[model samples]
Target: MERRPRARLELSDRAWQVLAQAGGNVAVLHRHLTAAGGQVPSLASLYRVVHRDLEAGRTLPDRAVVRRDREERHTRQAMADLALASPRQGDVAEAVLRLPRSSSTAASAVPVGESGAVAGVGLPAGAQLVRTPSVRAVAEPVGQAMAAEGAVCVFGDPGRGKTVAVRMALSVVPAVWKVTWVPVPVRPSVAGMRRAVFDALALPGRFPHTSALADAAVAGALGEARVLVIDEAQRLPVPCLEYLQSLCDHPGTRITLVLCGAGTERALARLPQLASRIAAWQEVPRLAAAQVAPVVTGFHPLWRTVPAEDLAWIDQSCAHGTFRTWAALTTHLQNALLTTADTSLDRALLARLCQRVAPPL
Candidate 1:
């Protein structure tokens, strides 16, 4: 008999599980296999195994790099807790957090009970929800534009959660749409602003000048994205804002253009043509006491560790109508919790935390 080919090896279910868990790290696989009473295969053999599994559709070739901002991290945990607590209707937004980005680049699904780091107790709910009448009034029209191809403008008070809402929308929208979120830096020079848009769109950096760059970037995004959300759009000088108006000139391209910023209404007023093109517009306002419960719920568990009464006071003081201040207070509270592990937050501790606030941005 022709020398029997060395018996071909077939990985057991246990081996496949180990490989999948390692996400194709060959070194890890080898170690696991050797420890499991199997000989460590040569690199070439390992490669074949992976290749074969991929060809057979047994494994995904690439793993995802998942990162979540603070509010989102909390929303994810809450949704998970909600899911286990009551399995009926899940929080649609939280489901998106858990989904793979490639599957839903803008939307993701968050796992419950992963950790308290992201969804701690102290996060404010108003930052996460669009509770303002102005925001609620415009959300549908904005959602329609997002569903089609175009953009909407969200202008509001500083720290009123303009950025937060835009992010939350991305967390809820369908995956087929591409959501490109760019926050316009404060007082950015015309040139720098254009560069930021280009980077967000992953376009080439070189540009003739600021004006040309703005014209090109908006047009480029309109050509590709389902929706382009520009946060802090109020900072864009008149010239750039006017150029942005041109992006929606053609109704056929199907692009949603969202312009968001503090006091954006004044900026939009200057661009008559762009303002005219705006099918919908609104000014998001600061959070109210009714909304404090949601904000408190969203705060990471670390925030919850602080006594409720102390948090109530901080909320009342920061409720002076600024999201930035609210954020600072939360950070201060987080630091206090980390260093002291003192769950019993009081008015005195609040005073110490308040000291950390930068003279009201």
Candidate 2:
């Protein structure tokens, strides 16, 4: 005898209502249905039913669509509330909302050879951003951390371009994810760190007085998916790190924490609890010897005019493959070219400028 094909599972009106109330979260809907104690399908089967309904033009929205709509609504409401609370802050909020939401938009936002700088390091107006291997190395782990909603630690020696590279990678993140860059204050306390997070998020109204109330506010705001970048994280004390861990550990919050600094690895090592949760540890090393000529030449037109051998000599003598040093050298070269028509870029002139910028070597 031929067996009958199993019937397709269907969602009831009540189930649909639960799904809607859950903001299209299928897992939540499944749990609700299971708790109601009826003939409930497996999670996988429920997902198939939902997918079928979606393709059939059902009114229920997909989880992601629903989430985006809700976030947009919340952002608008927050702006209005902030405007009423403080006009200056409201203006700031408006400016933040205008930030580029997609990778293409972000790339266009910062044009090459413009006055814009990365991570507060001054770049020469004639300098161009080159996508080096170090940048690609950073982008991979940063992207992974964002996708997994986990933690990542980006560490390197000073001037190795860790912050700049991380910023570059984050600039390309999809528009759906909210990215918050928290500037770690010098010698920060937990309270100070909490306030920094609150300010970074641009949460409306004044910060709360009590720690409990402040954390509640922060946790509530973090209910939506967000990537929190704590730059110069090495400055954070154990208490502050624990505080951040608490925020990430909140059951309702979906947070991807990125700790970036020169000694971030060592800092995280001090806190095994937080370190254990890191999904990736990316280190930005100095530019390789082979990359010196190409990277610096692409970085500025002045370098392009310099011979390959001279560029290598300069790297070996002073720049030592550091991006910050290259930026400084480029600025000096650009100035020398513009200010003095007679001045030519030679090893002698390069040596003088290198002495001004590079550490003793």
Candidate 3:
């Protein structure tokens, strides 16, 4: 059996900050280490260390600066202390119930990457829940399933705000609805895919075979009204998608399945049966150039730090369009934000950040 890595390093002050900002990417951790005048670890080794920390439920060490006010400091302490204490949908539901109240002025807002979800998000005016045709239709069915049972999937492009929209919708749900969010794994194989979903749901059983396990899992899920929202649904193989389709079969299941992805209409062509069974389908289009400004204006403050020209480029590129590309560009701008002093992005800065985060197109 392969042994898990055991090497550990005492993180520096800057390392903690970088880890907090990077979320969980080991590549970013290595970059921050090198930038902070430390020897860099190999990619594999760094990943092992980061994964170990995550598994052990460790968070950034307490800082000595003590810069925050009493409330903010208390919130940070609580967050750190409760790092690994939150339960899943069918579990105790502590984290969802005890979420920190939104500050009148947020201390910092993090950007959502193509693969990650953004918190404290807002929808653009025309994209509002009441006005947007696509979003409005999708929201009702989703809200119904959520009220009946917590948890559901809102599959879509990486930065198309699938997660954001779900978060918004859940906010309207009653407190009795226990909401827990996790990113859907985008693995390729059937077995690997099953493990991903099982691990995500934190289900109790395991299977030696992927097919058998998937059927059993879906059967069990269909008995309850719990919504399992699978984002990036296009990436799942045919077998995996079929299992989701099976959930629609049970009437009492009330399991609402929302699948969002780039070119979803085209992607669904590959699964005609599953596609036809979908009760509601919503197309989330990229914001047009004219629509980008208002959207950006309504974005979280940290996002505002991105230069206007960069936002314009993002809007244009996304309009062309691809969620994968938009997500990559957003990560670049976020890294730039950490170093910028005047605290806003510039065209040159945006260009440089883009180049560094993504390859030449």
Query: Which of the numbered candidates is closest to the native, going by highest TM-score?
Result: 2
Cα lDDT tens digits, model 3, 59-138, are 65333333223333453343334321222333224222211223222111223331122244443222222112223334
Ranking by TM-score: 2, 1, 3
Error of 3 at 69 (Å): 48
Q: Which 10-residue span in candidate 3 carries the lowest summed lDDT?
A: 124-133
Model 3 bad stretches (over 4 Å): 1-141, 144-158, 175-197, 205-218, 300-359
lDDT of 2 by residue, 1-361 (tens): 9999987687889888678768777999889878889777889988888999989999875667666666656644543343222212432222122112222211122344222225454567855565567876787777666656789899998988888777666655545568888988889998899999999999999989898989999999998778899999999889999998998889989888999999989998889999999998988888888777666665665676788888998889887878888888888787887898899788889888888886665
In model 2, where do residues sit more than 4 Å from their true spots? 1-110, 113-121
User: RMSDs, each prediction?
Assistant: 15.0, 12.1, 22.6
TM-score of each: 0.56, 0.71, 0.47
lDDT-based ranking:
2, 1, 3
Q: How many clashing pairs per prediction, in order?
A: 35, 0, 8
Error of 1 at 323 (Å): 4.0
Best by lDDT: 2
